[model samples]
Target chain A: MSDFMEQFAELRDQKRFQDIVDAIPYARLMGVELGEDESGELLFSLPFHERNVGNTVLPALHGGLIGGFLENAAMIHLIWNRESLDTPKIVDFSLDYLRSGRPKTLYASCEITKQGKRVAHVLIEAWQEDRSKPVAVARAHFLLATTS
Target chain B: MIATPVNPKVFEPMGQLFVSLPHCATLGFQYLGADGRKPVLKVDWREDLVGNPATGVVHGGIITSLVDTTSAVAVTAHLERFETIATLDLRIDYLKAATPGKAIYCRAECYRLASQVAFTRAVCYHDNPDDPIAHGVATFMRESSPLPMLQEPKA
Candidate 1:
C-alpha cells in the first residue's frame, strides 16, 4: 500500500491524467485527451479521426466509439481523483443515444453520483457543438479499487 | 417501412455488410454467419486493442462495442432484411475480464420486433458461452436511421 501511495503521489506531481490516458490503448486509439474547459475544469475530448467514422453516408462517428469514449471518460476521472491505490473496474454501463454523434470533436465530463467503500456510481454527458444539446448521456457503476 | 418477406438468403449477405463497415473493418470484426441458426460475430485479439498494458487485458469498452454491434446486427435475423436502425439504449454487464491473447466471440438475438423498435440480448465469450465475459441487452430504434451503410446489396 505504501509503495502504491508513493507512486500515486509521484504522479500527482507531474502530468498525472495525461500519463494515465497514454497507458490505455483504446483511449489512445480513440484519441482521448484531457484538457481544461473554458472554466478550467478538467474535460475529456475525442478528436476527429477518419477511421472513427461509423456511418459513412451521414459521416457520423461510430456508436461503439461514442460509447467507449464515455466509458473511458468516467474511468479517467475516477483514476485522476481516486481515493484508493487499487485500480477501479467497471461493473455495468448503460447509455442513451440522444442524437447522431457528429463527425467532429466530442466532449465529455463525469460526475461521481455516489461513492462507497466498494462501489461508486457515475453519470456522464457528451456533447458536440452545443452543450445544451448532448449527443449522448450515460450512467455506470464501478467497483472501486479493492485490496488485492 | 418496406414490407419485405423473411428471406433466409439475406442472412449471410447482411452479415457481410456489417463486417465491411468502416468501423467494424477498422476493429477487425469478422461476421461468422449463423451457426445452428444463431448468428455469431468475432474480433481477433490485437496488441493495439489492449487496454491494460500491465496485464494485456482488452478494454471494457471493446466488449461494449462488440455487444452493441452484434445486438444491432442481430436485428436483421428477425426482420430478415437490412434496414437502418439506431441504438436507443444499451446496458452491458461485465461478468469478468476477458482472457488476453484470445479472440472474442459474440452471439446476439433480436427476440422481439415491434413496429419501430427491436429488443436484443448479446453475450461475449472467449471459448465458452457458459462462461461469458460480458452480457448485454440493447434496444434499437428501427427505421429511424438514415444511414446509407445498408444499401440493398444486389442479390
Candidate 2:
C-alpha cells in the first residue's frame, strides 16, 4: 500500500476526522470548527471575527466567507463519511443568499443528495440564531475518486 | 433602502472603502484602478490562503471572494455611486485550479442595473484573460441610498 493509503486507513479511525478538517489552511484561517449535534450529525461552525467581515457598513460577514465555510463543510463531511484517500474536487458551486450573514457564530450542515462511484452531489444550508431561517443555501457537485 | 441620486465623485473614495474592509485586507486584495471600462482587483499568492497544503494551490473560496467582490465593485461603478448592496445569488464555474505562486486578477462588468437589482458577470485569471481560471455570474440587491459612512480616518 502507498503512504497516502496507509494514512487514509488511519484517518478512518473517526477520532482523527476533526484533525483532518483542521488541517485545511483556509478553514483554520477562518476559525472553522467541527463538532457533533444532538443527533450525532457532523456540524461546522465559524466564530465571528473582524477578519471575516466583508461589509463594514452593514457589518455583515462576507458572502464569500459564508460560501467558503459551507463548501469546506461539505468536503470535510464527504471525507469523514467515505473511505477515500483521494481528496474530492469541486466541479461547481452555486449559492443563494436568502439573507445577510450577520456577524456572529454561524453553523452549517450538509446532506449528500446523491453519491455515485465517481461523483457526488451535496446540499448545504447555513443558519444563524434559528435553523428554520437559513441565511444561505448552496449546491455543490464534486468529483470523487478513491484509491482502494 | 431609500433611493437617491449620488455624486459621481463617490467612485474615487470607493477604493479606500474596499481596502478598509477587514476581509479584503485579510485576503490582501488590491483595488487596481479601473481598466478603461471595468474595475480590476488583484490578490497575490499567499500560503495561508492555500487549500491543498501539499500542492500549495490557493483555495477556490479565495477566487470566489475575488469574483464576488469584483462584481460588487462593478455594480457600484455602473451606478457611479456608493450605495448599499447585498449579494442575492452567485454562480461560479471553475475552469481550472490557480497556478501556485501567481497573483490572480479579476475584472467584472455590470450588465444590467434595474431599479432595485444589479446583474454582473466576472472573469478571474492569472496571466491571460483568454485563459480564465473561473467565471462567475452574480446578482445584487441595490439599496436606494448610500449609507451615512465617512472616509477612513487618516493613519
TM-score between candidate 1 and the true structure: 0.91
lDDT of 2 at A16: 66
Off by over 4 Å in 2: A1-9, A146-148, B1-8, B144-155
* Backbone clashes in model 2, listed as residue pairs: B3-B144
Model 2 chain A: lowest-lDDT 10 consecutive positions: A1-10
Instruction: Give TM-scores of the second chain, every candidate.
Output: 0.88, 0.86
Q: How many angstroms is residue A122 displaced in model 2 relative to the true structure, after the best TM-score fit?
A: 0.7
Give lDDT tens digits, candidate 1, residues B1-155: 43332566555566777677777787899988765335789999988788767668888778878887888777877765667788889999999888999999999888788999999999999998888999999999987765545657675
Candidate 2 lDDT over residue span A40-96, tens digit each: 888888989999998877678998888888888887777667776777878889999
lDDT of 2 by residue, B1-155 (tens): 42322333665466556656798889899998776446789999998898776678788888878888888877767665446788999988988888999999998888888999999999999988889999999999988226633443355
Assess the local accuracy of residue B103 in candidate 2 as a C-alpha lDDT between 0 and 100: 99
Please give the RMSD of candidate 2 to the true structure: 4.6
Residue pair clashes in candidate 1? none
* Candidate that scores best on TM-score: 1
